[model samples]
Target: MTPDLEKELDDFKLSHYENADFDSLTKKTIQLYNKFERLKDKKKQNRVVLDLYTLYLQATEILFINSHALSVTVDRFPSALFIDSFNLRNFISENFAKTTELSSWFFKLIFSVLKDNSGTNEKYNLYTNLIKEVAKDYLGDYDLLNAYKHGYRVKANHSQTTLSISVGNGQHFKLNDSDSTITYFSKETRDGVPIVLQHTLNFKIGRIFGKCLFVCSLLNNMRAIILLHYKKPVSSKDISSFYINDKDEWNSMFGGSHFKQPVFSLKGLNKKNAIPK
Candidate 1:
């Protein structure tokens, strides 16, 4: 980004912070955290956790967009006004890349926990299958995020009548005249007329980030449950290992035993037979 654009974005974000509803955001986060803590069913737990993870991802996207701006020139206006580019370079490289890896790992581990702990395979299959269904879309997101991981740049340039962002080698994203629509040009086109692309923001980065945020929230909830139920560490590997090492011990200690004196059962006892014989 140009120096002017960067400055403008900083100012814009600062303003947003000043006006943002921290109180509401805080309350909502706490409410979800508490709900996650008390959940007993694995499916419900996973769903809540996903919601939290998606929230964080969405928040990160908002932060990145708020922090960056693009300068666009117009035919009639004397100066270019700044607009958000919603670029994925910073969000992906700095934070969401690691998040994507961890979310996948966490999801698999949580599924394993459900499958292992449950008595019936049908219930586990029901929940895990749901995740698999929703997860198909996230798989596509992983593909897009993989492209940005290996050091990509997003820069915007403008002539008097047109403005575009240079996304990659021979890949330019231009704003369509109709509001926030974007267009793409690529090597396959060979300098042909630009192809009208769908909204890259909502489809690509936004969708992925939203899914990550959902997963993150559920992961946090799972962490809380593990801490409470197992008294174990929050690290995924550690939690799994601790459960493995301690499961037998828990069963031995808590499983079943008979008292020397019967307190509740009255079998083989009658009024006359009550006397020791």
Candidate 2:
């Protein structure tokens, strides 16, 4: 590549990173965190349920977008600019597995630099596991998200509601209540017996917001590593510095709860004879 063209490409790459607005994402996360805390103590149960569901969906989308940003930074792939959950899921899966040739190459390249700069296996594993957890949380809610996006099919079910169905041929299945915020049901068939797949997603409001903050921190950390790999200078005042220095404050504010996995059950077939009006 010619020197002038090379410099132009370099400038473009730097500009892209600068314009990602990760700082804004961090601020939004903090705002959502405060909102979640306040909403938890309110007396209106129905309104609170809707508010929490909205917040959880927003937080999850932010996490997915941040992961997409990180993937683009790692490989400088132009196609990654467009946000598609299907592609994002593949990227997350590939990175977590780190077995494919492309994933192995990039994974080693990125983490090797991280290891050198941080110089600790503990920190390395911590970040690695964080990525894995994020991937799991995102993929686990993929169907619920699609339900929201495609047709707004999810319903807010009251706490302690059980979904029981009778599949034909004497087979029956039930989904006991777990106090989830929203529930989604879809129809399917299993061995000639119809069944309804029930999907329930529950979130500890604080932890959901915490995962958003976690995504912001991971994005900045990986951005720095990617820039370093390309020999680009990272500023001392970068967003990563704040997260690294004030880890305790955010950790405390977000609390220590792990991400709750969404529940799925195949309840029995929808048959006119199965129910009494």
Q: What is the C-alpha lDDT of each candidate?
A: 0.35, 0.53
Index of the highest-TM-score prediction: 2
Per-residue alpha-carbon lDDT of candidate 1 for residues 100-208, written as tens digits (9 for 90 to 100): 4433443454555442554444533433333342344332222223223332311111112223568658898864211111122111111432222211212222222
Q: Judge candidate 1 at residue 13 and give its lDDT.
A: 39
What candidate 1 gets wrong by more than 4 Å, as runs, is 1-15, 69-86, 90-277
Writing each residue's lDDT as its tens digit, candidate 2 over 199-260 gives 65653444455556666664565566656757778775453521234566435432111223
The count of backbone overlaps in candidate 1 is 11
* TM values, all candidates: 0.26, 0.56
Where is model 2 more than 4 Å wrong at Cα?
1-8, 40-76, 97-119, 155-180, 185-197, 225-237, 241-277
Model 2 TM-score on a 0 to 1 scale: 0.56
